[model samples]
Target: MILERHGLGWAGLAIGLIAPFFIATPYALNLMTTAAIFVMLAVGLNIVVGYCGLLDLGYAAFFAVGAYTSGILSTELGLPLIATVPAVLVVTVLAGLVIGGPTLRLRSDYLAIVTLGFGEIIRIVATNLDITGGPSGIFGIPGLFGDALSGPVALYYMVVVTAAIAVVLAARLGRSRLGRAWRFIREDEDAAEASGVRTYRVKMAAYVAGAVWGGLAGVLFAAQLSAISPAGFTFLHSALVLMAVVLGGMGSTPGVVLGAVVISLLPEALRGLADGRYFVFGILLIVMMLIRPQGLWPYRSREHGTSTPQEAREPERARMEGTL
Candidate 1:
């Protein structure tokens, strides 16, 4: 049964990989490209928030760092988007360490607040710094592979490849020993530490991993838009990604990806809503929260678990793994 499911999943992925070949309209292609970027961000956050049980309200900070890094470098230095990948990884890691080092020691509410503050700091610094071009942001950013590979079709594939890489890396990480440590920490931090798990380092690893992927997604964002600004990275943007992780079922990769796609495409889908859409959206969110607080696609029950009365009432274990 497992192999059958895997085969079907991979087959579906193959078809989705070729989806852009059939999508000829620039508008449709652009929408899909944006969705891919959203998926990348959600997946990256999954590492920290979903798997590790950390509450990061400022994940957009890493995302902004990545996009700005590539945007500034490519536009000001005559560098290619591909050339900015390493820097994005490095800068984001440093940013994660600088931020995570100070706050990972705190429990939930504190961590969340600190991360939220970190996010605002990144944006405020960008707004005040000339290197980030202030409010105008860095425009005319270059794409990967230059103009020869700058067509919509090329970009679609480029983003698809990058998102695919992130998904694979995240999945692989989740299956490793470190991943298990993260899970342990999430389930019970004190117990994890008692069991000889270095909770601090494990949490830091999750944070850094998330930062790296988030940063890479930023590079793709810069290449796709070829322009960026403070407006692009906002509190609402961070909240939306968090909503995707939650609504899609925190910790499940497939669920989170689906959440990312829906969250990204929702505004376009609601174009007919016009001025009333946001109002309706709030209503729907309230309804959904009441009806399915676990999210749109929730984690599956474990196959071999004992259903102790208390355990039965407990929340389901995350089948996939992502940050909420």
Candidate 2:
């Protein structure tokens, strides 16, 4: 399964890398670039929601953190946007800990509510901050490259390559020891704890990882648009990221990527009927959910040996009993 998945991923990457050759229009490039950025966000959020079973309604807060941090640093210090990436990472990781450390203890709907509030708080704070340019936000930012004319095209390719690498890395993480721990916690936190997994620590790690991914995406966003405001990072953005995860098959990498592309491009595709685009979008989401709530690419866990928990633990329990 893993090998097959990788093969498909590589094929997709190849297609993405060469897609510009076939469709070089500016509109096409812009749409593809946007979809790639959206894919990064969805993949990151999947680590929280899919891998760790954490409902993070405020995932966009981390996105905001990265964007604002990078924007402030670059604009204030006369630094290049790329130069602020390290600072962005540090800020995002800290933000994750600050938020996840306290709130990850909550379960299900409670966690969702708190995250929702956190998302709102980040947006509101950005809205009021003078450095963030208040409601008007920041503009006149430099592009990723020195040349403005070629910057968009270069950035588009950069985003595609980066997104492809990120997807592969995320998949690799999902197959690692830490990934297994996340699955255990997702399956049953109590069981994972009983098995000696540090549930809180593991959850925090997932949250932080997700934050880093989101923050990086934000940096790309700031570079691409060369401007940003509080309005760009809102509950709606968080909800859409979550929707991509759910719509794509939460734990499935390929699924989430597909879902992000669909969500990002569906509106553009429907723009011909400007008045009814949103309505059509809503109907499509409803139909997809109703028809395949599990998602377009549901996760399929590998087969495990059929050893009962008690049987697997019997030797340890017996040894401990004898020692006692």
Top candidate when judged by lDDT against the true structure:
2
Best by TM-score: 2
Error of 2 at 142 (Å): 1.4
* Reference-based lDDT, residue 196, model 1: 66
lDDT of 1 by residue, 1-324 (tens): 111135544664676588887987899989998999899999899889877889999999999999998888888789999988888888999998999998999998999999999999999999999999999998888778767789888998889877877777786676566866776677778766766677899999999999998888888888898998999998898999998888877766766777888888877878798998878777877787689777666544244343221242233233212222
In the predicted model 2, the residue pairs found to clash are none
TM-score per candidate? 0.90, 0.91
Query: RMSD in Å for candidate 2, one decimal?
Result: 4.6
For residue 149, give model 1's deviation from the true position in Å: 0.5
lDDT of 2 by residue, 1-324 (tens): 241366777788888888888985888888899999999999999999988889999989998998888888878887778789899999999999999888999999999999999889999999998999999999866665535433667888888878877888788888677876776677678767776777899999999999999999998898888899999998889999999999988777788888898899999999998899999999999999999888877666543332222232334333323332
